[model samples]
Target: MTSSAPSTRIASKLGLSDRIFAGPRSRRLLSTVEAGLERVDAALVRELAMADSLANATSRYLYDAGGKRVRPMLALLTCQLGDGATDKVIDGATALEMTHLGSLYHDDVMDAADKRRGVPAAHEVWGNNIAILTGDLLFSRASQIMARHGEAAIRLQADTFERLVIGQMHETTGAQDDDDPVEFYLRVLADKTGSLISAAARTGLTFSNGPAELEGALTVFGEKVGVAFQLLDDVIDLSADPDETGKVPGTDLRAGVPTMPYLLLAQRSDTSATALRERIDDGVAQIADGADPELLDDALAELRDHESTQATLDLAHRWSAESIDALAPLPDGAVRDALTRFARAVVDRSR
Candidate 1:
């Protein structure tokens, strides 16, 4: 704590949800959050440290580079519903972040991404085998930390990991001929991205002994927010700025990964879209053969202007709105309003 914790504070009295804008209680709670986040950051570094030199370097790479820390934030935020950021909540938040960082390693390897967080991807620097091992190590460490929190934490971590794997698998295999690509991709978003976020929210409630009734609503809310977040990412990929996004625009197309905008384009039989899709397919092939990602520039530029990009944006907004609706069970107050803002803010990035 920047300021030492009180002997104890009544969780409900903090009134963090409704008074976020102004009030002595709001300022106190904000300080508590700042202190909690700082502790989370430090704990992540300590957890990533290892006795083995190679493992230490690889495992710590992206965690050190930095992230939005959204999952950890949600963990801490929901804890306010109960006892606030207890030591257990902080540890759970740190573990939640590690779970996310671990997935990045596997994602980079699958996408053949060259960089992450403004640095070379682990696979790029250390080769895929080493990178994959490092990711596994992170997951293992997260599990070990969860062990401290008992069975519920362990179970949550396991369930999230299962969904993460399923989502990645579906993304990798792609939609079958009979499957709806848009729906498939949304499901991918749910499992791959949403599941972990949902678990993070659950961690706060489960670990902090928050209201039992809010669990279902929070779970749905987290998943929808996750889907919305990824849908926005689909738009972001086509309009990437290296300095801002840490990856070039068209990285997904170049890597031949399917995206919502591209999927929308594929569904159309329009002469113009069909022509553009063919060209993108050609560029993606070049990338698969080790060609420059910039080769996709022209097509991605076209995609940015295409109606499909707008369609994707609209889809994101819909999901975001739905996430807010899921907060219905939450008492109508600052907490629910704050979460609504959070849902909007999550998908509003780069808009």
Candidate 2:
């Protein structure tokens, strides 16, 4: 398929455009990846196009808005260790991104989020029923693309889909009586965010004929890095200005979502946290009722400056370091170095 070179924004989003292109060899690899990503973009639009005009528009909505495309980038990067970006690898990357986009539509509905990627959420534009159906349509398209790759890819997609659903189910049901809330939250992050990422990394190996030994390492690396990424986002959610994050500060807290910082604060028995916890609870209730914006804003500002927020940041660094450690088994080279930098960037990203 014909495609243009990836834009600077797309390259920066993958965390490896200008920075990694220092040497001729590195520049060539970067060009290859850029070309592959362009193909992936084309494939996404082609596959998501529908016979019905309304269905086509809704399916293409999020794709047009753009995203980090981290999953597909990981898939393409790992492919460098093997046969590079083959047609199958490109298709695999496209399918993974489609699955991710589909999940976002469903996630927005569940979270009652008004916006995604700086635009109105699909649910907000088309109502919940159409949004949910659009997500299902994308999922079906992903499966159709995966089916072309073979049974293994299909199985991987199915397993990841199951994990995504199960993770959402647990999040909705909340923790069991004996469950440690912190542990429960981490598990949810792993299944919900990490599983698909792990699959994306593995798909590179599966499609590109990479060394089989590296598969498990990359999978673990992806999962740990995903969790670390989400943890960093927890900190960002509290600290990021609206312009940086494209969402209001304390959005999750206002929605009563149990973020890592909040969970950590809840575990503290210190008197300092007692007042903070009460205020947070009150803020949640107030926000839910659309009352007392000033009080909620004050509580959010307080929590943003709290020690638990710092603790959450520290935890993110720890996980990112663990993700780097997971790559110890791989041979030293540009691919491994790029992956390392990518993991670090996940925790360090400002937006």
Candidate 1, position 217, lDDT: 91
Best candidate (score: TM-score): 2
- Candidate 1 lDDT over 1-351, as tens digits, reads 022222112122222333332444334455566667778887887888889989988988887666777787677778888888888998898898898999999999999887887788999899999999999999999999999988988988898999999999999999999999999889999999999899888777777889999999999999999999889988887774775567777676788898999999999999999999999999988777888778889889999889999999999999999998999888755456656777886677763
TM-score of each: 0.91, 0.93
Task: State each model's C-alpha RMSD to the native.
Answer: 5.2, 2.5
Please give the lDDT score at residue 169 for candidate 2.
93
Off by over 4 Å in 2: 1-9, 12-28, 290-295
Among all windows of 10 consecutive residues in model 2, the one with the lowest summed lDDT is: 1-10
In the range 233-267, model 2's lDDT, one tens digit per residue, is 88888764775555667676777777899999999
List where candidate 1 sits over 4 angstroms from the true fold. 1-28
